[model samples]
Target: MKIAFPYMGTSHIAFKMLIRDLGHEPMVPPKLSKKTLTYGTQHSPEFACLPFKILLGSYLEAIEQGAELIITSGGSGPCRAGYYGVLHQKILQDLGYDTKIIVMESPYRNPFDFLGKIKSVISCSGVSWWTFIKVFYKAWEKLKLLDETEFLSHQIRPFECLRGETTKVFKECLNVIDESQTTEQIREARKLTQELLNNISQDHTRKVLKIGIIGEIYVVLEPFANHDLEVTLGEMGVLTHRSIYLSDWTRESTGYESKKNIIKAASPYINELFGGHGIYSVGHTVLYSQKGFDGVVQLAPFTCIPEIVAKTILAKVSNDFAIPVLTVFLDEQTGKAGLQTRLEAFVDLLGQKRAIQEGVVT
Candidate 1:
């Protein structure tokens, strides 16, 4: 099938690889733009989260580009993301588009659910269910590894100050991996990219404020949605770390139950305070705090319930643990200037907090 997938930050890179590996022509929608967001917001229900609206724009664009199938994921939760694919399908249909919508639902609930969907999308004659499972697992491993590496590179990018060299290398690495290349080749590419990044002149003497960004995946990873906050923060001499990369979500899918059990065993207080997915965010926040990060920044798209819950718990965690926290809520109207101003103020506050902690301020 000539399939298309919407851009959801870095995950789109991995999705492109998965689509190629499955022998489908994957059309990636152009990067998020004003027109894209406007189109999405106009078509989607007002109450839908920002990521859904932005993604809808992507699908609308892709369908116009001769795509026969629209590929998206399914979630199961109180979160609206679970229903996004269905909602987008209905919306597109109402708009007179007749593209096939392929939603890869979570198999954790019913393996048959996913298998049936895949069968409907791709007609494979007499292919055993086990064969499909093996292929899916292998694709998932590649996706998770690529996602984790990209996330790590993002965390390291802002501190490098290499005038976009880090960003360039990161983009090149994605393109290299998407070419159906060997795993060993991809590893070598990553090593060369890292070496190039390390060769850049970075100031180690500067006392940069360390900040952690935690929130919904799309908003945290999409440069357009967040107005390139990481770059802006880096330029302001603030070292930033983010939670909610693709690998993190993939791990949650594979071992969420066990991980949750362990977290509950280790930190019952956290589990009780932040129920459901928020517990994972809380656990990560606590880990970041213990690592001596100067502050924490909680980011969320407007009306994201999971992140809202996580934000509240993180506020308490920050207060109790003596870490400064800044919560930024993003919506269609979120302005770049406003975001930069808030980030600057947050960085300044962190610097003051650090100075006081180190007795640099008397």
Candidate 2:
């Protein structure tokens, strides 16, 4: 089958590899752009969050390009993300598209069912179960490497002496990673990726702002949806650490359940899972503040309930921890210029606060 999936940052690199290795063609949609957002917004419910609209737009385009099956992740929560598949299926049917959609839910919810689903998909390839296991392991390893490389880029981008050099090297490294097929190739790519990043000339004497990024996973990961907020922050001399990564989420959802500490950290504010990553966001914010980050930026869709909840609690977190927090809600209509202005002002605020604490200002 010709399978397709929506884009989320560099995740497509791994997903494409996984699908192709499974003996299916991966029909990735075009990169997200204004036109894509417009198509999604036109077909999507007006109140749907930006991710939903963007994904719908991607699906439409992929279907138009002859995608036979669409694969998407699903959730069970008060968050609207849980219902996106059903709603999307209905919408596509209404629009006269009969594409098959496979929604992968949390394996922890039903391990047997999850394995059964995986077996059915693997059966399509006529490949042995051991082969499927090896392929999936390789894909997962690649995802971890990709996430590590990206995290390193965020740390290095702010300190690079030559403007845009870090970005240029990062892109080249990603291409190297994408082409890596074997375990040894991936390890070599990792070494080269580290070497390339370490070679970027950096101003060690320059003081940089440390910022933690938290919020809805889609907006946090998808650069287009967030107006390239991570790269923009890096370019402005701010080092950013995102709270969530695809590999981490995948590991936890696949029954590892290693986030108890994060959940415990959120106890003082939001003890229970309020659907989505509300508790995790709060926990990560608290953790960032303790780590002495200068500020935190929370990105969310306009009507994202979990983020809204986190935003409200974050105000208290900011006051109690003496850390600055900025919440930016995104949508199809969000403009880059406005976001840029807000970020500049926020960074300035952090700088002034730091100077005051050091007695540089009275």
Best by TM-score: 2
In TM-score terms, candidate 2 sits at: 0.98
**How large is the C-alpha RMSD of every model relative to the true structure?**
2.9, 1.1
lDDT of 2 by residue, 201-251 (tens): 999788899999999999999999999899999999999999999999999
Error of 2 at 62 (Å): 1.0
**TM-score of each candidate?**
0.88, 0.98
Model 1 misplaced regions, further than 4 Å? 124-142, 256-258, 261-277
Pairs in steric clash, model 2: none
Measured by lDDT, the strongest candidate is 2
Error of 1 at 186 (Å): 2.1
RMSD in angstroms between candidate 2 and the native structure over all alpha carbons: 1.1
Model 2 segments beyond 4 Å from truth? Answer: none
- Per model, how many backbone clashes are there? 0, 0
